[model samples]
Target: MTANPLADDITQAAACLGGDGLLAGEVQGFAARPQQQEMAAAVEQALTDASTLIVEAGTGTGKTYAYLVPALLSGKKIIISTGTRHLQDQLFHRDLPTVRSALGVPLKAALLKGRANYLCHQRLHMTRSEGRLGDRRQANQLEQVFDWSGRTASGDIAELSNIPEDAFIWPRVTSTTENCLGSECDWFSDCHVMKARREAQDADLVVINHHLLCADMALKEEGFGELLPGAEAFIIDEAHQLPETASRFFGMALSSRQLLELAQDAINEYVGETGELDGLPDVARELEKATREFRLEMGQGEQRAPWSRLDGNPALTEAREALKTALADLAIQLEPLSERSRGLDNCYQRALRVQTLLAQTTEQPPADYIHWFETWRQSFRINLTPLDVSENFNSQRHALPDCWVFTSATLSVNDSFSHFAHKLGLEDATTLQLDSPFDYANNALFYVPKGMPEPSSPDYTRHMLDETEAIIEAARGRTFVLFTSYRAMNLARERLRDSCQFPLLVQGDAPRNELLERFRELGNAVLLGTSSFWEGVDVRGEALSCVIIDKLPFASPGDPVWQARIDAMKEGGGNPFMDEQLPHAVITLKQGVGRLIRDMNDRGVLVICDPRLLGKRYGRVFLNSLPDMGRTRDLDDVVKFFHASDALSL
Candidate 1:
């Protein structure tokens, strides 16, 4: 047998991460961790052999540096994907530089986000000339963006922090795949999206979020050109989120917002370029009215339901027909005007795409897809999600590169990676699990409160809040009360508002980052939040001392997409609860419990108020999946633990 030549790099990579090595001499207070070094060796081996590797490095494992050192040493053109845009920024602007500088490697890097993140010069100009603002405030916001456009070089909206990311004005000033005129755009020379992609193509390393990666995968599936440059290796930082994100992009979606935007754009183009002929403006206005009427028929409040729910309702049926007719009328009117200008041509193509998706949605869905609709306050989305994305995701992975590394903190359940592997059809990949180097055994306490009602009971939130109040008081209000549902979080907020004394911060009262900043600054505030707060949150030192979970984080049976998958699993001769639901819940619970004990010196109590943790048979799966902390059922033990910490602090 021939010896592998690149195997020497594994040892070199591990040595560089070791004590008395390059990093130890460069970074201050950088303690050498055995787990991080082991992970770096495994990543190096994967890169050398051009194979697949999965690693679940627990919290505080320094996974970022572990994968990065090997990637830089290999000198391969690499693409690193993160779970969120904020993480992308952190890795590109902060972590990447630290590692590259420590290794003294001169690798060029780039940060690429989706097109929507960059401001579109053409759209900004059209929005300014159209003068169709909703109010005076929107007009002022447009002027602010316009003024900043000249001074900015990158055109990334994140650079302008005066306007919120979710402000209504952003949609008017940005572009999407549907509305963006590729090379025909007037501002093609100065396009921010193109500029970012060009940099990514030229750099040796590119950092992007999951959305852009999946978008490239879906585009390739459609035989379109790739959005990303070819790379020798792809390292997914938060691999646990890949399957879900891939499923979304692999499927199809048509939104009411897209339809309304097409209508408005068509009217604007007609006024600017085309003559007032054939009642084109009137037809576009009809589409606007039909879209709003259809939204009204979806009923009040946010909701998600299977498309079959519209089978028997006559009003919904009529509204859908009106929407379809309005779209067809607009398409017919714009087909002739497409040659008038590039903007009209883009609108015509968008209208046809929406028409096709609408027709497919109203028909009998394919056997392998779940047809569902979701609605919010002002918009709705009709989605066709695949029942199993294993085949599709596997194909995309194979097409990408010879080497792949999928690493995350919560990718395994009960110390096994089978569930995650099966989701993405990565059964052949090598797997490794590295426990956190933090002192969880000595610093953290896992408390499952006694006398808790069933999670489904009407009085569950009331009782859970009643118990959490005492713990918050004992911990001096440095607590995060994480819930599985908005209903529960809101109820806890309402009850605590009257009884608790500390500063209360709720999720909807402000933005997520804003709420987190307040929680840290107050030093003694109780923060209530839902699923978004479970993971991707960091609080160290004495600021955060307790975490209270209302229940096991399980997929709700009421969700249409989840229910469809559960039913499909049953039909395929699988135990829906055991094979699917239980494993998913175990992984999610691990992420929630991971909020505490971020550092070696951090000490806190983890409170699971769900009685099922002790009452059900599968509860052991969840408990075993979490870190090996001291477990207790007594409330007095928690109070005493906090009291001991307070004395030590003094």
Candidate 2:
């Protein structure tokens, strides 16, 4: 006779992980893994004790199901948050359902995205009432969304697969916190966002992303139904991204794009509300003009300068004052008009929010902050980012008396969770590390080329191109040449443009998803990318066999944020390089390397061309952090691994 799976017995949790209990004949191709069972047991224990748990479940530990099975069967309200919406969707729509069916647990699960994702019925009505938002392409895109809004059960913009989310028209028809009418919205009765939140409020489980989690923590910004106070367990997937993302939310930011959008939203609201522009449209236009001129005055390209820089420079100070005055003037004009339209009232609130944000950005950086301004992609942004968000994170952690579980494939480096734990204020949490189940000795090779110069050398790109091309030849074009910067990625892409025979897919040539699809379809292709490609990407099989990292993934010293963190770490009797930077880089590198051997049958070569990884003493940390793949310097060994992988694929 089997014991109750819901009991606090860890053995029962272990049994459910097997094929005989809840998983009996329900999980196809089930292979019982001890490491998975161990992690599951740990999660179950944490839930029972209502304690915090930090789990570094390496690739192939089946960590998702390990935690989910216990959480669902516990019959407690659990909130699972991931670093990205893509992973959130996977857990809620795919993995959770699979586990729930097998366990036969009577659990209610809900998927809640940030408000920007859900269609604002109020905004949609306004968009229709005010026609032709942009060019013909944008018009067509809006028409498609208009059609999708009618049929989408979830009202998630992700449902409209044909139109890209970054389309210029999407913002005109979406609501931001600044612009949302909240309960005052005429369409509040049928609000998709509120409805989704209501589901989460009533659910046994809710899956959300890090941004929303952080937002909810800092300000109850989402108001997406209270989380920590209600859920019995908090499980954070891809926990490595939590600290940095939390830092962003805890900081202050004001973008020209956001102000411009506010201005535009105001214009749309005026037209939609009174069915006439009537002097209000001119106020928004003037503010936009001042904003554009201000952006130009901030200068060309990405520039990060201190508040002192802005104070001393006449052009910057003038631009700053002009923009500030314009925003205030815009608010003044909106006061009377706000009474005319509730939409205008929303826009009025948006202007005031921007004013507050701009003021926050211009102020002196608080004790643990780094402030700067930068222009990227033709938009100027000002930021005052926190040097540490641990305190803020801990506050959220204590908001409810519940178990907290942090799990990721690459959270710990050198079998130590101090770096990840301290970063997220989880120093006292229980930590566990599980290695990949795959036999990396036979399936993968960790190769480092002999006698390579430092990455700082001018000849780095040329040498990297030479060595990467050779590796691609050995792998027969199933390669991902990961770079540390855009300069290197573009340099290698240009050099390999004509030399390679296989389809050469560059990162910016198309959308990341499209690039991966093309790489898979081509079966043998070389894709070159920078930071964005390093993580959250999964390509199983021989289509991706060789991963060639150009350099040790280091945070650039030039970044104002990195500089502030280094200073902060130094102030606390710590070696910033050893304590903060190195561990972070090792985790990132592990993520890149883990891409090679995804499944049990998968086989590949991971060639890191950075020689500093061999010369530097701290490089031992990275070496120790990666999977225990068979090490080799011989190019022929890479050739052999690729041949074996290719044969297996065939």
Q: Which candidate leads the pack in lDDT? A: 1
* TM-score of each candidate structure, all chains considered together: 0.97, 0.96
Top-TM-score structure, candidate number: 1
> Where is model 2 more than 4 Å wrong at Cα?
1-10, 223-225, 273-278, 304-311, 647-650
Local error of candidate 1 at residue 404 (angstroms):
0.7
Candidate lDDT scores, in order, read 0.88, 0.84
RMSD of 2: 3.2
Please state the error at residue 382 of candidate 2 in Å. Answer: 1.0
Candidate 2 per-residue lDDT over residues 283-383, each given as its tens digit: 88888998898888777777766554565578877888888998998899888888876778888878888898887887565667878777775788888
Candidate 1 stretches with Cα past 4 Å from truth are 1-10, 220-229, 275-278
